[model samples]
Target: MIQKAQEFMNENHFADVSRVQCLLRKMMSKEYHGLIDQIKEYQDPHAIFNIHGGNNLIAPTASQAEQKLVEKPADEIKKDKE
Candidate 1:
């Protein structure tokens, strides 16, 4: 399964393996277990969704959309300056 994922990523020119790993980890969470199971049983692991710059390939999901929101660190918080 991992091998097929790697091949799919390579074939699609996915440059961020770490990002993909993070996404996979999130998908494996209990909250998404059912979705993962369904995907594992039916979807092709090699399927790719080309996004941003045509270099970033990702599986489409709500979490992927949520990840776009940039988070600010504690030190960078505006209230910290006050």
Candidate 2:
């Protein structure tokens, strides 16, 4: 999971910081030492959106005209198509 997260950060140019948790345990882990860093972390509020994942992709909503088109009588729609 950490390696996956590392890749995500690398691709997105991000640095990880716990919302508030300290990394004392991680820092103590020799296995993670090479992957760890001590630095000031700041949040860019606008950067909260996803860049790669379509997770943030919003489905386009039907406009009032579109909704009306759907609600129109089939006969009326057929007449317009003619």
In terms of TM-score, the best-performing candidate is 1
Per lDDT, the best of the predicted structures is: 1
lDDT of 1 by residue, 1-82 (tens): 4435555454455355566555665756554433233222122344333244434456444344433434565345434444
* Alpha-carbon deviation at 31 in model 2, angstroms: 3.2
Q: What clash count does candidate 1 reach?
A: 0
lDDT score of model 2? Answer: 0.37
TM-score for each of the candidates: 0.28, 0.22
Which regions of candidate 1 fall more than 4 Å away from where they truly are? 29-82
List where candidate 2 sits over 4 angstroms from the true fold. Answer: 14-28, 37-82
Report the poorest 10 consecutive residues by lDDT, candidate 1: 34-43
